[model samples]
Target: MKLSVALIEPEHEVNVGHIARVMKNFGVNELFLVNPKFDSKKATIFAVHGKDLLTKSKIIYFKDLRKFDLLIGTTAIYSNNRSNVIRDSINPSQLVKIIADSKQSICFLVGRESTGLNNTELSICDIVVSIDTGTAYRTLNISHALAILLYEIKKNSFQKKTNLATVHERVLLIDYALKLAKVSGYRRHKTSLLAMALKRFLGRNLLTSKETMLMVTLFRQALLTIERKRRKMF
Candidate 1:
C-alpha cells in the first residue's frame, strides 16, 4: 500500500515543515497541502533532512480527493458528537489493520490547527480515524497528530513487494468508469458516487502487474465498444 499525508489549510508553516520531517522519519514521501498558509522559508528551516518532502509536496483541492483510494480523516471530535455518524471515527490500531491488508494509495487528511475537518469533508472520507490521548488534553498539534498516524501506518501497512496498480493506472480506470456511467444514462451525481465507490474497491483489492494490465485493457475495450455502438446508431 502507498501512504500519503494531506494537510488541509494548515495554519502554521512550522507545523507543515515539522510534518514533512516526521513523514520522512516514518518512510512516507507523498505530502499534499490544500489552500495552506505555508511560508516556504519557515518550512525550509523546519524540514531539515526532509526538505525533499517539502520540495516535492503537492497542492490539491477538496475535489481532488479522487486521487486517493482510501481517505482517513483525523479529528479530535469523538464520542461527544456521535449523532453525526459519519464523523465518528476508528482508532489508529483499527486503521492499521485496514491499510496493512489493502493495495491502494491511502491518504490521511489532517485538518486546520484551530478547527478540525468539518462535517462535509469527513462525510466524504472512507474512514475517520483518531488517536487516543489523555482526557485532560483532548487535542494534539498538527505535526504531533500526523506523526502518530504515520507511525501506525508504517507499522501494520501492506508490504509492497509485488506488481500493483499505480495511482496513474487507477485514475485512468476511474475516468473510463465515468464515461461508462454517462453512456448508461446515469446522472452526474450518481455517477460521481459510483466513481467514488469504484475507486475504493480498486484500491482495496491488491492487483498484480498482470492483473492491473488486464483491467486497463478491459476498461479500454468497454469504452471503445460504447463509442462504436454510438457511431452505428448515428
Candidate 2:
C-alpha cells in the first residue's frame, strides 16, 4: 500500500516543513502539496533530515487528486447528518484498521491552518476522519495533524509483502469479464451490473498479484466453456 500525506493549499512554510519532518519519522516518503505558500528554503529549515520528502514531493491540482483510490480528509468539526458512516473521532488503532482493510493507494489530506477542509473538498473524500482531542477548540496545526495521522498509519499495520496490482491489471480483469458476459448473450445492462459486482467482489478480497493472476486464468477458462456451449447451439 502506497501512503501519501497531501497538504491542500497550505499557507505556512514552517508548517509544511514540520509536516515533512513528521512524515520522515514515521517512514512516509510521499509528500504532496497543492498550492503551497512557501518555497524550499522555509520548508528545509523545519524538515531537518526530512528535506528529501520536500524535494521529492509532488505538487498537483485538486482535480489530479482523483488518481488516488482512497482519499481521507481530516477535519476538526463533524457535519451532523451529512455522512453515511460516522464514528467517534478515529484513534490511532482505528486508523490502522481502516488502512489494513483498504486495498488501494491512500491519501491523507490536511487542509490549511486557518480552516479545516471546506464542504467541497470533504464531498470528494471517501471518509472524513478526525483526530480525537479533548480541547474545546478542536483545531490542530497542519503539521500536528500530519504527525498524528502518520503515526497511526505507520504503527501496527502489517507491511505489504507484495506489490498491489496496478490500475491496468484491474482494468484487464474487468475487460475480460465484460467480453465473457457479451458472448453469453447477457443484456448490456445486466452485463454492466455483473461486471460491477465482480469488481466489488474482487476488491473485497484484496487479492495478491499471484492470486489475481490465478483468478484471471479461471475467468479465461469459464469464458472458453461458454464459447464451447455457444458453438454447440449453432
Candidate 3:
C-alpha cells in the first residue's frame, strides 16, 4: 500500500512543515496541498530535515483527488445521529483494519486548523475517520492528527491481494447508480441520501477493480433498459 498526505487549505505554515516532517518519518513521499494559504518558503524553514518534501509538494485542486485509489478524510468531530450521515466516522484503529491488506494508494486528507472539514467537504470523501482523543476537547492539532494516523497505518497495515478500485472508478459507479435511480423514478431528495450512504458503504469495504466494474456495468444496463422501456411507452 502506498501512503500520501494532503492538507486542504491549511492555515499555518508551521503545521504544513510539521506534517511534511511526519510524512517523511512514515516513508510517505507525496504531499498534496489543496488551495493552501501558507507561504512555501516560510513552511520550509520549519520542515527541518524534511525540507525537500515541503519544497516538492504538489499543489492540486480538489477534483484531482479522484486519481487516487482511496481518499481517507480526517475529522475531529463525531456524530451519532444516523440522519447526520456526513459526520459519521470510524476510528484510526478501525481504519487500519479496513484497509490493512488492500493493495491501493491511499491519501489522507487533513483539513484546516480552525474549522476542519465542512459538511460539503466531508461528503466528498470516500470515508471520514476521527481520531479518538477520549476527551471533551476532541480537537487535535493538524500535524498531531496526521502523526497518529500515519503511525497507525505504518504499524498495522500490510500489502497483499487484488488491486482495489480507484477513486475515479468508485465515483463513476456511484454516478451510474444515481442515473439509474433517476431513470427509475426515485425521488430527488431520496436519491441524494442514497448517494451519500452508498459512498460510505463502498469505502468501508474493499472492492476489487473487477468487482466495481461489474457493478458499474449492472447499473448502466439497468439505466439503458429503463430508458428504452419509457421511450417505447411514449
Highest lDDT: which candidate? 3
Looking at model 3, residue 24 earns an lDDT score of 83
- The sequence of per-residue lDDT tens digits that candidate 3 reaches over residues 117-228 is 8888888777899988888999999999998988887788455657777777888999999998887778998877899988998998878789999999999998888888
Candidates sorted on TM-score, descending: 3, 1, 2
Q: Where is model 2 more than 4 Å wrong at Cα?
A: 82-92, 101-103, 158-234
Candidate 1 lDDT over 1-234, as tens digits, reads 678888888888788889889988988899888888878677879988998998989889888976676688888888665235655677888767556746677888899999989877876676788777968677899889888887776667455535556767766777877877788788876765576666545544545567767777887798799899999999
lDDT of 2 by residue, 1-234 (tens): 678888888887788889888888988789888888777788799889999999999889988887986667788875444222222144556557655735578888888888867867865665567876887877888788778777666556565535555555665777887887788787886764565455444443445667677767887999999888979999
Per-model TM values vs. the true structure = 0.67, 0.64, 0.86
lDDT comparison, 1 vs 2, better candidate: 1
The deviation in Å at residue 221 for candidate 3 is 6.2
TM-score of 1: 0.67
Report the Cα lDDT for candidate 2: 0.72
**Clash pairs of candidate 1?**
none
The candidate, 1 or 3, that scores higher on TM-score is 3
